[model samples]
Target: MKKFIPYILILIALGIFAGYYMYNKPHAETQGAKADITINPADLLAAFELDETKANAMYLDKIIEVKGKVKSINEVEQGGSISLDTGNEISSVICEFEHAASIDGVKVGDEVIIKGFCSGKLMDVILVRCSL
Candidate 1:
């Protein structure tokens, strides 16, 4: 027990340092980062709708560039989000920006390309850390 005391202390110190480092890790910048996959909103929705598991395997956690007409913009307490038309009537691709400035100049009916990290679908396919 005496011999192990120093090793245990060192392990505890390393654990604390690792926790602090993880807590302070910066978010990934999507604005200038290249996308892993690029697909239109309609097709992207269709893929998920047809086979959610396969879609999840392919798109989940990947940076995706989606091109479609802007359906709507929503401002919430956290930040602003944009819904892209998917022709599904009930579902759309929801792109979430960390700040409003990321979505500036975008409007409904405008054909645009947006990039984000896929977080899987609820009613709508959600993308986080989006950029124009």
Candidate 2:
């Protein structure tokens, strides 16, 4: 049993290092990055509405670029979010940014293209870590 002590210690140390590395890992840069899937806001919403399971398998965690008129703009403590009109008052594509300043000049009714990672559908389709 004593002979395994050193091995156990090494394993613990390796685990700690791995955890720290993963915790501090940088987020993927979305600016100027090519999107994995590009779709219109309404089309995206329709796809999710039609088949949530299939949409989740295709869009979740993948970079998505959508072009639409901004339906609303919102600011949060950490960043900002904008909702793109999806032709449905009840649902829209919400894009989130890490920097509040990212939405500084943006306004509702403005047409813009946003790129982000598709998170999932929750009434609205959510896109995180977005960029213009």
Candidate 3:
């Protein structure tokens, strides 16, 4: 009985350690998740008020999400695409999704929130996800 008691205690301790490890382990979706910081295009435009060239230079290859209205829908040989107005007075912001068909339900002039990673000056944003 005494020997069994020590074994039981060790097993219990190992079980607790396993539970804590599982509970604190990083999730696949959040392993490299970007910071939750967000900047509204309108506010960013108003604050920095950068021209297209400057804005392009600043936001290129950066991770950002912008909320705006859909200005138009376009279809190319590659795939469908949507343009978003960043509430910028100078130039409209554009976001292109690899699979534009996913956004088929969205139409011109619909308000939407878009999250993506910025690619370059062309506002070559990759739409990670979006919502109306």
Whose lDDT is greatest here?
2
Which order, best to worst by lDDT?
2, 1, 3
What tens digits encode model 3's per-residue C-alpha lDDT throughout 3-64? 79989999999999999999999623311456343676555454334465675566545556
Residue 130 of candidate 3: its Cα lDDT?
Answer: 32
Q: Output the TM-score of candidate 1.
A: 0.82
Per-prediction TM-score to the true structure, in the order listed: 0.82, 0.82, 0.52
The root-mean-square deviation over C-alpha atoms between each candidate and the true structure, in angstroms, is: 3.1, 3.3, 7.8
Better of 1 and 2 by lDDT: 2
Q: Per-residue lDDT for 76 in model 1?
A: 69
The whole-model lDDT of each prediction reads 0.93, 0.95, 0.59
Q: Candidate 1's residue-wise lDDT over 1-132, tens digit each?
A: 899999999999999999999999999877899999999999898999999999999999999999999999987678789999998789999999989877788889999899999999999999999998
lDDT of 2: 0.95
Question: Tens digits of per-residue lDDT for model 2 on 31-87?
Answer: 989999999999999999999999999999999999999999976778999999999
Evaluated at residue 12, the lDDT of candidate 3 is 100
The candidate, 1 or 3, that scores higher on lDDT is: 1
